[model samples]
Target: MSSSIWSSLPFVAIWSVGYWAVHVPHLLFLSLRNTIKPLRPVPQWSYRLSMGTAVLRAVFRYIGALRYQQPLQLTPGRSGDRFVRIAPPADANLFRGVFGAPSAMAKPAPVSAVWSPAPVVAPSSSHPSDGRRRKVVIYAAGGAFVTGFDPEMSSRFTSALVTSEHFGATNLLFVQYRLATRADPFPGGVLDLFTAYQHVLGLGVAPADIVLIGDSAGGNLVLALLRRRAGLLALGRNNSRSGGQDRALAHQPVRHHGRAGSVLGVDAYRPKGKALTQEEEGYISPMDHPFRLETPLYIEAGGAEGLLESIVTFAGQMADVKGNRVQFHITEDMPHDFFVAYPFIGAKKESCEALKRAKLFLEG
Candidate 1:
């Protein structure tokens, strides 16, 4: 029988405690192993930071499985990138949140990225104040499509991109979609994002000036939205969009496919141990079909990433498409969505460098 997220609360609580108790040994092993790996040396705290994120992620997915109409505290303020109610433009969709982490805002000209109580309005296709052609980044946050990573993490990502002078982005429109659990399946969530792409077009932002950006599963969604004709930049799943983790086998999160199955949001399209329905299998292995992605792409993964091989394959295939301009970036020793986890692990220097490289991609 199906259960709403409300019914899953006790499990979330118990599992969090239980998982952490046993996760300590694996955490210690990873820390020691990571030390000898060829990846850049950051603070050792990153091991805990990554594991804690994984635990919180599992819990968030459980919470996100509730029906959309449920009485839950999932407003944008509480949502952490999980929700932003998008009604008709005339109804004035309510979106409220400040952009950028305090650390991000501390940089030069962070004001360019900060806003609150901002409505989803028809933005000028160019900077009205300066008459510069607008470059809009349609940002899709990554979280296995159940929950978002966190507000601060997303804000920091936005801050990094927006503050980049090289990228020259005038405005960024974050996409809102019914998550996998709420939408109840694959294309359902993708459909909502397709509408978001249309929304940007309606705002008079030309397809050429628009850039699509996503991390993790969100990256997969960006690739799907490419049929809409926007420039694409993503931290892709190995064939999975922002898969959160790789196939761990007995291991935890060893592989990320934009790919979640044994755990997390996979419960939506795939029930445990059951054969995937046609729709579910299609989503699980998207590259199985051919897509003519004419939009320019900047695909990336961490050198130490579990999703590395798949990401490489996906990017390679995209490059094979006639006239596809693809740029693949590999950040040495980084983990999946390292930029999102960097701040937590005190990797500010690396994060800034990443932003600079992303600027080059956007500018190209």
Candidate 2:
């Protein structure tokens, strides 16, 4: 080989190794963390093979490469990330006497990522004032029900939220729920989500001070949670939203879809298994629930995403039912999860505006 070519080969080899080290492990960990069990459990060897393939894909990102377009600029926050296990009240008892209670409590499914804002450099940029209740945002990520949670996406988004002048939130918790698979599908993931919500509440944050945010399937979970809360309150009021019951239950949660099922041959895009009935699917929807909520809800969606139709329908129905309590921001021509791309895409202006509105909603 020529001298020039030989000299340049080392740099190429070093770059390749660096990329492999960072990205391959990420894909592998994700595959393992969100394992798919078809019937009972995925066979050990098959699981390994599946993860190996995923890691390999990460290592070689482009087997059939397409010509690259202009890169989008994303201003991800410098927020610190931490992992913690959240357990139900009963589960907390199991760790009471354990030497490694924290570790033991963390072993269960549905790990969470906590992102703390960067230290304030400017006095004017400090956290919310003492008079104002510090906002605590519990974010759920969107990935059509089948895909598992994305921590990087969640962290990046949270970082943006807390660092930006719009939100200036101090505490952000991103829940990583079990993804839908053959063994753990549909409502199974929803249960884990409920536990996550309970865990947050257990931390003593008032339901009124909490802001629930979700995209795609995560959006589905958020709606489900509010619905459940509304249902509970309604039951206490004799399931009536009229007369004395309405006045008495005014403080209860007022409840408030997305797409990809088309490719899967199922309407809900549920995990690979049996299909769900319209009523069963509707049960998971946030639109069906009716009640009033003290907490404000902020929803962001791209107009171009597959789930736009369902999302628009849900937003419209909820807005009519709950009035100003539900806020919806739709960005034309944008795809799913546009907030994560706030710094780069042409649609970022709308995304940023949506967040600003969300901030205002929270302040009120």
- The residue ranges of model 2 lying beyond 4 angstroms of the native Cα positions read 1-81, 91-110, 118-133, 149-153, 237-279, 286-295, 322-324, 343-348
Q: After TM-score superposition, what is the CA distance of residue 38 in candidate 2 from its true location, in Å?
A: 46
User: How would you encode candidate 1's per-residue C-alpha lDDT over 1-364 as one tens digit per residue?
Assistant: 1364347879756866676677666556665666553431444335545555455444444444332222222355533443344432231111111111121111111001111113234556553434446566666666565554344345545646554664556666555444555234555445455555556556555666666667776776666555322212222212222111100000011233554432555555333434545433434444543356555566657776666777777767767878766677777766666655565544456656655566675455
Score candidate 1 by TM-score against the native: 0.63
**Model 1 Cα displacement at 207 (Å)?**
2.0
Best by TM-score: 1
Q: Model 1, residue 140: what's the lDDT?
A: 63
RMSD of 2: 15.5
Deviation in Å, model 1, residue 126 alpha carbon: 17
lDDT of 2 by residue, 10-120 (tens): 765676677668876776566656476452122332344345434434532421111111112122323242555555435442222211133221233544444444221
